[model samples]
Target: MNNNSNLSSNNNKILNTIDTVMGVKEEKEINQQQEYPPLNGQKLLIYVMGTLAQIGFMTLTLWLINLGFKQLLEYNLDVRINTIIVSLFWIFFTIRSRLFSPLDNTRSRRQYDQVIRPKWAPPAFVFPIVWISIGVLRVVSSYLVWQELNQNFLALPLIIFTIHLALGDTWNTIFTVEGRYGLAVPVVIIGPLLSSFVLAYVYGQILPLAGWLIFPSCIWLMVASVLVINIWQLNQKD
Candidate 1:
Protein backbone atom coordinates (compact mmCIF):
# COMPACT_ATOMS: atom_id res chain seq x y z
CA MET A 1 0.00 0.00 0.00
CA ASN A 2 2.89 2.50 0.75
CA ASN A 3 4.60 1.73 -2.59
CA ASN A 4 1.41 2.49 -4.51
CA SER A 5 0.96 5.75 -2.58
CA ASN A 6 4.54 6.91 -3.44
CA LEU A 7 4.00 6.11 -7.12
CA SER A 8 0.82 8.19 -7.16
CA SER A 9 2.63 11.12 -5.46
CA ASN A 10 5.43 11.01 -8.08
CA ASN A 11 2.90 11.19 -10.95
CA ASN A 12 1.17 14.19 -9.37
CA LYS A 13 4.50 16.04 -9.07
CA ILE A 14 5.39 15.40 -12.71
CA LEU A 15 1.96 16.64 -13.80
CA ASN A 16 2.32 19.80 -11.68
CA THR A 17 5.78 20.52 -13.13
CA ILE A 18 4.48 20.23 -16.70
CA ASP A 19 1.55 22.53 -15.94
CA THR A 20 3.88 25.17 -14.48
CA VAL A 21 6.19 25.00 -17.49
CA MET A 22 3.27 25.31 -19.94
CA GLY A 23 1.83 28.22 -17.99
CA VAL A 24 5.16 30.08 -18.19
CA LYS A 25 5.42 29.47 -21.90
CA GLU A 26 1.91 30.75 -22.40
CA GLU A 27 2.65 33.90 -20.43
CA LYS A 28 5.80 34.52 -22.51
CA GLU A 29 3.88 34.14 -25.75
CA ILE A 30 1.15 36.47 -24.53
CA ASN A 31 3.72 39.11 -23.58
CA GLN A 32 5.38 38.84 -27.00
CA GLN A 33 2.02 39.24 -28.71
CA GLN A 34 1.26 42.33 -26.65
CA GLU A 35 4.69 43.86 -27.34
CA TYR A 36 4.87 43.47 -31.14
CA PRO A 37 1.85 43.02 -33.30
CA PRO A 38 2.24 40.75 -36.27
CA LEU A 39 3.39 42.53 -39.43
CA ASN A 40 0.58 41.56 -41.72
CA GLY A 41 0.40 42.28 -45.45
CA GLN A 42 -1.34 45.66 -45.00
CA LYS A 43 1.23 46.89 -42.49
CA LEU A 44 4.10 45.88 -44.78
CA LEU A 45 2.50 47.61 -47.75
CA ILE A 46 1.98 50.77 -45.74
CA TYR A 47 5.60 50.78 -44.62
CA VAL A 48 6.96 50.34 -48.13
CA MET A 49 4.65 52.98 -49.56
CA GLY A 50 5.70 55.44 -46.87
CA THR A 51 9.38 54.88 -47.66
CA LEU A 52 8.92 55.31 -51.42
CA ALA A 53 6.83 58.44 -50.99
CA GLN A 54 9.48 60.08 -48.85
CA ILE A 55 12.20 59.23 -51.35
CA GLY A 56 10.12 60.57 -54.21
CA PHE A 57 9.30 63.77 -52.36
CA MET A 58 12.87 64.60 -51.44
CA THR A 59 14.25 63.78 -54.88
CA LEU A 60 11.54 65.80 -56.58
CA THR A 61 12.24 68.80 -54.38
CA LEU A 62 15.93 68.73 -55.19
CA TRP A 63 15.32 68.19 -58.89
CA LEU A 64 12.94 71.13 -59.00
CA ILE A 65 15.57 73.31 -57.40
CA ASN A 66 18.04 72.26 -60.08
CA LEU A 67 15.53 73.04 -62.77
CA GLY A 68 14.87 76.44 -61.21
CA PHE A 69 18.57 77.23 -61.27
CA LYS A 70 18.85 76.29 -64.91
CA GLN A 71 15.88 78.43 -65.89
CA LEU A 72 17.14 81.34 -63.84
CA LEU A 73 20.47 81.14 -65.61
CA GLU A 74 18.85 80.91 -69.05
CA TYR A 75 16.81 84.07 -68.44
CA ASN A 76 19.79 85.99 -67.11
CA LEU A 77 18.54 86.33 -63.59
CA ASP A 78 20.63 88.29 -61.09
CA VAL A 79 23.63 86.34 -59.84
CA ARG A 80 22.91 87.26 -56.22
CA ILE A 81 19.29 86.09 -56.51
CA ASN A 82 20.34 82.85 -58.07
CA THR A 83 23.00 82.33 -55.43
CA ILE A 84 20.57 83.02 -52.61
CA ILE A 85 18.02 80.63 -54.03
CA VAL A 86 20.54 77.80 -54.41
CA SER A 87 22.07 78.47 -51.01
CA LEU A 88 18.74 78.54 -49.20
CA PHE A 89 17.59 75.41 -50.99
CA TRP A 90 20.75 73.54 -49.99
CA ILE A 91 20.69 74.93 -46.44
CA PHE A 92 17.14 73.68 -45.97
CA PHE A 93 17.98 70.15 -47.09
CA THR A 94 21.27 70.12 -45.18
CA ILE A 95 19.51 71.13 -42.00
CA ARG A 96 16.95 68.43 -42.55
CA SER A 97 19.44 65.67 -43.50
CA ARG A 98 23.10 65.53 -42.67
CA LEU A 99 23.49 63.11 -45.54
CA PHE A 100 22.77 65.98 -47.94
CA SER A 101 25.33 68.40 -46.57
CA PRO A 102 26.72 70.89 -49.10
CA LEU A 103 29.76 71.71 -47.04
CA ASP A 104 31.10 68.18 -46.78
CA ASN A 105 32.70 68.25 -50.22
CA THR A 106 34.41 71.57 -49.64
CA ARG A 107 35.61 70.43 -46.25
CA SER A 108 36.76 67.14 -47.75
CA ARG A 109 38.76 68.81 -50.49
CA ARG A 110 40.46 71.18 -48.08
CA GLN A 111 41.32 68.34 -45.75
CA TYR A 112 42.44 66.12 -48.63
CA ASP A 113 45.03 68.63 -49.78
CA GLN A 114 46.15 69.23 -46.23
CA VAL A 115 46.55 65.52 -45.43
CA ILE A 116 48.07 64.41 -48.75
CA ARG A 117 48.01 65.51 -52.37
CA PRO A 118 48.10 62.38 -54.46
CA LYS A 119 49.78 62.66 -57.85
CA TRP A 120 46.92 60.70 -59.41
CA ALA A 121 44.15 62.82 -57.91
CA PRO A 122 41.84 64.53 -60.36
CA PRO A 123 41.90 68.31 -60.70
CA ALA A 124 39.85 70.38 -58.26
CA PHE A 125 37.49 71.44 -61.04
CA VAL A 126 36.83 67.84 -62.04
CA PHE A 127 35.59 66.53 -58.70
CA PRO A 128 32.97 69.18 -57.91
CA ILE A 129 31.38 69.03 -61.37
CA VAL A 130 31.49 65.26 -61.47
CA TRP A 131 29.87 65.04 -58.05
CA ILE A 132 27.21 67.54 -59.03
CA SER A 133 26.34 65.48 -62.09
CA ILE A 134 26.35 62.32 -59.99
CA GLY A 135 24.02 63.97 -57.52
CA VAL A 136 21.54 64.71 -60.29
CA LEU A 137 21.79 61.13 -61.50
CA ARG A 138 21.23 59.87 -57.97
CA VAL A 139 18.03 61.83 -57.76
CA VAL A 140 16.95 60.51 -61.14
CA SER A 141 17.61 56.91 -60.22
CA SER A 142 15.91 57.28 -56.86
CA TYR A 143 12.86 58.82 -58.49
CA LEU A 144 12.80 56.04 -61.05
CA VAL A 145 12.99 53.37 -58.38
CA TRP A 146 10.35 55.12 -56.35
CA GLN A 147 8.02 54.97 -59.33
CA GLU A 148 8.58 51.21 -59.53
CA LEU A 149 8.35 50.41 -55.82
CA ASN A 150 5.51 47.99 -56.42
CA GLN A 151 7.41 46.09 -59.10
CA ASN A 152 9.63 44.19 -56.59
CA PHE A 153 12.42 43.84 -59.15
CA LEU A 154 13.97 47.27 -58.45
CA ALA A 155 14.18 46.63 -54.73
CA LEU A 156 17.67 45.15 -54.63
CA PRO A 157 19.25 47.93 -56.66
CA LEU A 158 17.78 50.65 -54.46
CA ILE A 159 18.93 48.84 -51.34
CA ILE A 160 22.43 48.50 -52.76
CA PHE A 161 22.51 52.16 -53.77
CA THR A 162 21.48 53.26 -50.30
CA ILE A 163 24.33 51.28 -48.81
CA HIS A 164 26.70 52.66 -51.41
CA LEU A 165 25.72 56.24 -50.61
CA ALA A 166 26.10 55.68 -46.88
CA LEU A 167 29.51 54.07 -47.28
CA GLY A 168 30.74 56.76 -49.65
CA ASP A 169 29.70 59.54 -47.28
CA THR A 170 31.25 57.76 -44.31
CA TRP A 171 34.46 57.13 -46.23
CA ASN A 172 34.74 60.79 -47.12
CA THR A 173 34.17 61.93 -43.56
CA ILE A 174 36.54 59.43 -41.97
CA PHE A 175 39.25 59.46 -44.63
CA THR A 176 39.10 63.09 -45.67
CA VAL A 177 37.81 64.95 -42.62
CA GLU A 178 38.86 62.71 -39.73
CA GLY A 179 42.05 61.69 -41.55
CA ARG A 180 41.48 57.99 -40.95
CA TYR A 181 42.76 56.66 -44.25
CA GLY A 182 43.19 53.10 -43.04
CA LEU A 183 39.46 52.61 -42.59
CA ALA A 184 38.40 54.91 -45.40
CA VAL A 185 40.32 53.15 -48.16
CA PRO A 186 38.49 49.90 -47.62
CA VAL A 187 35.11 51.63 -47.56
CA VAL A 188 35.85 53.51 -50.76
CA ILE A 189 37.03 50.43 -52.59
CA ILE A 190 34.32 48.07 -51.42
CA GLY A 191 31.45 50.54 -51.59
CA PRO A 192 32.05 51.48 -55.22
CA LEU A 193 32.73 47.94 -56.36
CA LEU A 194 29.51 46.78 -54.73
CA SER A 195 27.65 49.68 -56.27
CA SER A 196 29.05 48.84 -59.70
CA PHE A 197 28.00 45.22 -59.43
CA VAL A 198 24.47 46.04 -58.35
CA LEU A 199 24.20 48.72 -61.03
CA ALA A 200 25.26 46.19 -63.67
CA TYR A 201 22.57 43.83 -62.42
CA VAL A 202 20.02 46.62 -62.40
CA TYR A 203 20.87 47.56 -65.99
CA GLY A 204 20.40 44.03 -67.18
CA GLN A 205 17.31 43.11 -65.22
CA ILE A 206 15.19 45.97 -63.91
CA LEU A 207 15.66 49.44 -65.42
CA PRO A 208 18.25 49.87 -68.11
CA LEU A 209 17.88 53.65 -68.37
CA ALA A 210 18.28 54.20 -64.66
CA GLY A 211 21.29 51.93 -64.62
CA TRP A 212 22.85 53.81 -67.53
CA LEU A 213 22.23 57.07 -65.68
CA ILE A 214 24.25 55.70 -62.76
CA PHE A 215 27.21 54.68 -64.92
CA PRO A 216 29.03 57.97 -64.43
CA SER A 217 28.97 57.47 -60.69
CA CYS A 218 30.65 54.10 -61.12
CA ILE A 219 33.28 55.56 -63.43
CA TRP A 220 33.97 58.40 -61.02
CA LEU A 221 34.25 55.90 -58.21
CA MET A 222 36.88 54.00 -60.16
CA VAL A 223 38.84 57.19 -60.65
CA ALA A 224 38.41 58.03 -56.99
CA SER A 225 39.71 54.59 -56.07
CA VAL A 226 42.80 55.14 -58.15
CA LEU A 227 43.38 58.41 -56.35
CA VAL A 228 42.89 56.70 -53.00
CA ILE A 229 45.35 53.98 -53.98
CA ASN A 230 47.89 56.57 -54.99
CA ILE A 231 47.37 58.41 -51.72
CA TRP A 232 47.95 55.19 -49.79
CA GLN A 233 51.09 54.45 -51.77
CA LEU A 234 52.44 57.98 -51.36
CA ASN A 235 51.52 58.37 -47.72
CA GLN A 236 52.88 55.05 -46.43
CA LYS A 237 56.30 56.73 -46.29
CA ASP A 238 54.83 59.34 -43.97
Candidate 2:
Protein backbone atom coordinates (compact mmCIF):
# COMPACT_ATOMS: atom_id res chain seq x y z
CA MET A 1 0.00 0.00 0.00
CA ASN A 2 2.82 2.41 0.93
CA ASN A 3 4.78 1.60 -2.29
CA ASN A 4 1.71 2.25 -4.44
CA SER A 5 1.09 5.57 -2.73
CA ASN A 6 4.66 6.76 -3.33
CA LEU A 7 4.52 5.77 -7.00
CA SER A 8 1.30 7.72 -7.50
CA SER A 9 2.77 10.79 -5.83
CA ASN A 10 5.85 10.70 -8.11
CA ASN A 11 3.69 10.31 -11.20
CA ASN A 12 1.60 13.32 -10.25
CA LYS A 13 4.73 15.42 -9.77
CA ILE A 14 5.97 14.50 -13.25
CA LEU A 15 2.62 15.44 -14.79
CA ASN A 16 2.60 18.79 -13.04
CA THR A 17 6.11 19.54 -14.28
CA ILE A 18 5.10 18.78 -17.83
CA ASP A 19 2.06 20.99 -17.54
CA THR A 20 4.15 23.89 -16.30
CA VAL A 21 6.59 23.54 -19.15
CA MET A 22 3.84 23.34 -21.74
CA GLY A 23 2.13 26.38 -20.24
CA VAL A 24 5.27 28.42 -20.49
CA LYS A 25 5.82 27.41 -24.12
CA GLU A 26 2.27 28.33 -25.03
CA GLU A 27 2.57 31.71 -23.31
CA LYS A 28 5.79 32.46 -25.17
CA GLU A 29 4.14 31.68 -28.48
CA ILE A 30 1.26 34.00 -27.68
CA ASN A 31 3.63 36.80 -26.76
CA GLN A 32 5.54 36.35 -30.02
CA GLN A 33 2.33 36.51 -32.01
CA GLN A 34 1.30 39.66 -30.22
CA GLU A 35 4.64 41.27 -30.89
CA TYR A 36 4.21 41.03 -34.63
CA PRO A 37 0.61 41.13 -35.68
CA PRO A 38 -0.35 40.31 -39.25
CA LEU A 39 0.27 43.12 -41.72
CA ASN A 40 -2.66 45.22 -42.84
CA GLY A 41 -2.86 45.40 -46.62
CA GLN A 42 -4.38 48.84 -46.67
CA LYS A 43 -1.76 50.26 -44.34
CA LEU A 44 1.02 48.80 -46.44
CA LEU A 45 -0.46 50.30 -49.59
CA ILE A 46 -0.72 53.72 -48.03
CA TYR A 47 2.86 53.61 -46.77
CA VAL A 48 4.15 52.62 -50.19
CA MET A 49 2.26 55.40 -51.94
CA GLY A 50 3.36 58.01 -49.41
CA THR A 51 6.98 56.94 -49.59
CA LEU A 52 7.04 57.11 -53.37
CA ALA A 53 5.54 60.56 -53.39
CA GLN A 54 8.07 61.83 -50.86
CA ILE A 55 10.96 60.36 -52.82
CA GLY A 56 9.83 61.94 -56.09
CA PHE A 57 9.38 65.32 -54.51
CA MET A 58 12.75 65.18 -52.76
CA THR A 59 14.59 64.18 -55.92
CA LEU A 60 13.06 66.98 -57.97
CA THR A 61 13.76 69.56 -55.29
CA LEU A 62 17.39 68.56 -54.95
CA TRP A 63 17.93 68.59 -58.70
CA LEU A 64 16.46 72.04 -59.13
CA ILE A 65 18.43 73.38 -56.16
CA ASN A 66 21.62 71.92 -57.58
CA LEU A 67 21.03 73.65 -60.91
CA GLY A 68 20.21 76.93 -59.22
CA PHE A 69 23.28 76.79 -56.99
CA LYS A 70 25.52 76.18 -60.01
CA GLN A 71 24.12 79.22 -61.76
CA LEU A 72 24.51 81.32 -58.62
CA LEU A 73 28.16 80.33 -58.35
CA GLU A 74 28.87 81.77 -61.79
CA TYR A 75 27.74 85.19 -60.66
CA ASN A 76 29.65 87.13 -57.98
CA LEU A 77 26.89 87.30 -55.40
CA ASP A 78 27.67 89.37 -52.30
CA VAL A 79 27.07 88.57 -48.61
CA ARG A 80 23.35 88.73 -49.34
CA ILE A 81 23.67 85.41 -51.12
CA ASN A 82 24.52 83.88 -47.75
CA THR A 83 21.11 84.96 -46.51
CA ILE A 84 19.48 83.30 -49.52
CA ILE A 85 21.37 80.10 -48.83
CA VAL A 86 20.27 80.15 -45.22
CA SER A 87 16.65 80.71 -46.26
CA LEU A 88 16.88 77.85 -48.72
CA PHE A 89 18.25 75.49 -46.09
CA TRP A 90 15.47 76.46 -43.72
CA ILE A 91 12.79 75.88 -46.36
CA PHE A 92 14.24 72.56 -47.44
CA PHE A 93 14.44 71.18 -43.92
CA THR A 94 10.99 72.50 -43.03
CA ILE A 95 9.42 70.84 -46.06
CA ARG A 96 11.37 67.64 -45.53
CA SER A 97 10.20 67.30 -41.91
CA ARG A 98 6.83 69.02 -41.82
CA LEU A 99 5.33 68.25 -45.20
CA PHE A 100 6.22 64.57 -45.16
CA SER A 101 5.82 63.67 -41.49
CA PRO A 102 4.63 66.47 -39.31
CA LEU A 103 5.36 65.50 -35.75
CA ASP A 104 2.75 67.86 -34.38
CA ASN A 105 -0.14 66.26 -36.26
CA THR A 106 -3.09 64.96 -34.24
CA ARG A 107 -2.33 61.37 -35.12
CA SER A 108 1.29 61.76 -34.19
CA ARG A 109 0.45 63.38 -30.88
CA ARG A 110 -2.05 60.65 -30.08
CA GLN A 111 0.41 57.93 -30.89
CA TYR A 112 3.11 59.54 -28.81
CA ASP A 113 0.78 59.92 -25.87
CA GLN A 114 -0.27 56.28 -26.07
CA VAL A 115 3.30 55.02 -26.00
CA ILE A 116 4.86 53.82 -22.73
CA ARG A 117 7.62 56.36 -22.53
CA PRO A 118 10.26 56.53 -19.84
CA LYS A 119 9.92 58.89 -16.91
CA TRP A 120 12.62 61.05 -18.39
CA ALA A 121 10.81 61.44 -21.68
CA PRO A 122 9.62 64.96 -22.29
CA PRO A 123 6.09 65.84 -23.25
CA ALA A 124 5.05 65.68 -26.91
CA PHE A 125 5.08 69.47 -27.20
CA VAL A 126 8.77 69.56 -26.31
CA PHE A 127 9.73 67.58 -29.39
CA PRO A 128 8.61 70.11 -31.99
CA ILE A 129 10.11 72.95 -30.04
CA VAL A 130 13.42 71.15 -29.68
CA TRP A 131 13.48 70.18 -33.33
CA ILE A 132 12.77 73.73 -34.41
CA SER A 133 15.77 74.95 -32.47
CA ILE A 134 17.90 72.16 -33.89
CA GLY A 135 16.73 73.05 -37.38
CA VAL A 136 17.82 76.62 -36.86
CA LEU A 137 21.21 75.40 -35.70
CA ARG A 138 21.50 73.15 -38.72
CA VAL A 139 20.68 75.98 -41.08
CA VAL A 140 23.17 78.31 -39.46
CA SER A 141 25.93 75.70 -39.37
CA SER A 142 25.39 74.78 -42.99
CA TYR A 143 25.47 78.41 -44.04
CA LEU A 144 28.73 78.95 -42.18
CA VAL A 145 30.25 75.85 -43.72
CA TRP A 146 29.13 76.91 -47.18
CA GLN A 147 30.68 80.31 -46.71
CA GLU A 148 33.93 78.75 -45.50
CA LEU A 149 34.03 76.50 -48.53
CA ASN A 150 33.51 79.42 -50.92
CA GLN A 151 29.94 78.19 -51.56
CA ASN A 152 31.12 74.96 -53.10
CA PHE A 153 28.08 72.70 -53.11
CA LEU A 154 30.20 69.64 -53.77
CA ALA A 155 32.49 69.99 -50.78
CA LEU A 156 33.02 66.87 -48.66
CA PRO A 157 31.76 68.47 -45.46
CA LEU A 158 28.61 69.66 -47.18
CA ILE A 159 28.05 66.25 -48.74
CA ILE A 160 28.33 64.59 -45.35
CA PHE A 161 25.96 67.17 -43.90
CA THR A 162 23.42 66.41 -46.61
CA ILE A 163 23.75 62.69 -45.99
CA HIS A 164 23.25 63.31 -42.29
CA LEU A 165 20.07 65.25 -43.00
CA ALA A 166 18.79 62.42 -45.19
CA LEU A 167 19.48 59.90 -42.43
CA GLY A 168 17.54 62.00 -39.89
CA ASP A 169 14.58 62.15 -42.28
CA THR A 170 14.82 58.41 -42.75
CA TRP A 171 14.64 57.90 -38.99
CA ASN A 172 11.52 60.06 -38.82
CA THR A 173 9.88 58.02 -41.58
CA ILE A 174 10.68 54.72 -39.89
CA PHE A 175 9.86 55.67 -36.33
CA THR A 176 6.94 58.09 -36.71
CA VAL A 177 5.37 57.21 -40.02
CA GLU A 178 5.89 53.44 -40.07
CA GLY A 179 5.78 52.89 -36.29
CA ARG A 180 8.73 50.51 -36.41
CA TYR A 181 9.94 50.93 -32.89
CA GLY A 182 12.39 48.05 -32.83
CA LEU A 183 13.86 49.06 -36.18
CA ALA A 184 14.09 52.68 -35.16
CA VAL A 185 16.44 51.78 -32.31
CA PRO A 186 19.34 50.93 -34.56
CA VAL A 187 18.29 53.44 -37.19
CA VAL A 188 18.52 56.35 -34.78
CA ILE A 189 21.88 55.31 -33.43
CA ILE A 190 23.51 54.11 -36.62
CA GLY A 191 21.90 56.76 -38.80
CA PRO A 192 21.39 60.10 -37.08
CA LEU A 193 23.48 59.85 -33.93
CA LEU A 194 26.52 58.55 -35.72
CA SER A 195 26.15 61.00 -38.56
CA SER A 196 25.77 63.93 -36.18
CA PHE A 197 29.03 63.16 -34.44
CA VAL A 198 30.77 62.76 -37.76
CA LEU A 199 29.33 65.99 -39.04
CA ALA A 200 30.38 67.80 -35.91
CA TYR A 201 33.92 66.53 -36.20
CA VAL A 202 34.18 67.32 -39.92
CA TYR A 203 32.62 70.71 -39.52
CA GLY A 204 34.89 71.46 -36.58
CA GLN A 205 37.88 70.70 -38.75
CA ILE A 206 36.66 73.26 -41.25
CA LEU A 207 35.25 75.90 -38.91
CA PRO A 208 35.14 75.94 -35.12
CA LEU A 209 31.94 77.96 -34.89
CA ALA A 210 30.10 75.62 -37.26
CA GLY A 211 31.16 72.65 -35.17
CA TRP A 212 30.00 74.29 -31.96
CA LEU A 213 26.59 74.96 -33.44
CA ILE A 214 26.16 71.32 -34.43
CA PHE A 215 27.51 69.99 -31.12
CA PRO A 216 24.21 70.60 -29.35
CA SER A 217 22.42 68.62 -32.03
CA CYS A 218 24.77 65.72 -31.43
CA ILE A 219 24.03 65.81 -27.71
CA TRP A 220 20.31 65.89 -28.41
CA LEU A 221 20.57 62.91 -30.70
CA MET A 222 22.27 60.95 -27.95
CA VAL A 223 19.40 61.73 -25.62
CA ALA A 224 16.96 60.75 -28.34
CA SER A 225 18.72 57.43 -28.82
CA VAL A 226 18.25 56.56 -25.18
CA LEU A 227 14.61 57.57 -25.33
CA VAL A 228 14.04 55.44 -28.40
CA ILE A 229 15.61 52.34 -26.84
CA ASN A 230 13.58 52.73 -23.68
CA ILE A 231 10.36 53.27 -25.62
CA TRP A 232 11.02 50.17 -27.70
CA GLN A 233 11.61 47.99 -24.67
CA LEU A 234 8.72 49.39 -22.68
CA ASN A 235 6.20 48.85 -25.46
CA GLN A 236 7.51 45.66 -26.99
CA LYS A 237 4.31 43.77 -26.22
CA ASP A 238 2.09 46.59 -27.47
lDDT of each model, Cα atoms only?
Answer: 0.54, 0.67
lDDT of 1 by residue, 1-238 (tens): 9999999999767644543322212233322211223435774354345434444555555556546655677888787776566555433442233234332321224445555666556655355456655766765665465445542322556555544554455455445544545545666787655666576567436667777777877877877887777776667521
Taking all chains together, each candidate's TM-score versus the true structure is 0.52, 0.66
**Model 2 RMSD, rounded to 1 decimal:** 19.3
lDDT, residue 6, candidate 2? 100
**Candidate 2 local distance difference test against the native:** 0.67
Q: How many backbone clashes does candidate 2 have?
A: 0
Where model 2 places Cα greater than 4 Å from the true spot, the runs are 1-66, 70-78, 94-107
**Best by the TM-score measure:** 2
- How high is the lDDT of residue 133 in model 1? 56
Per model, state how many residue pairs clash.
Answer: 0, 0
Steric clash pairs (candidate 1): none
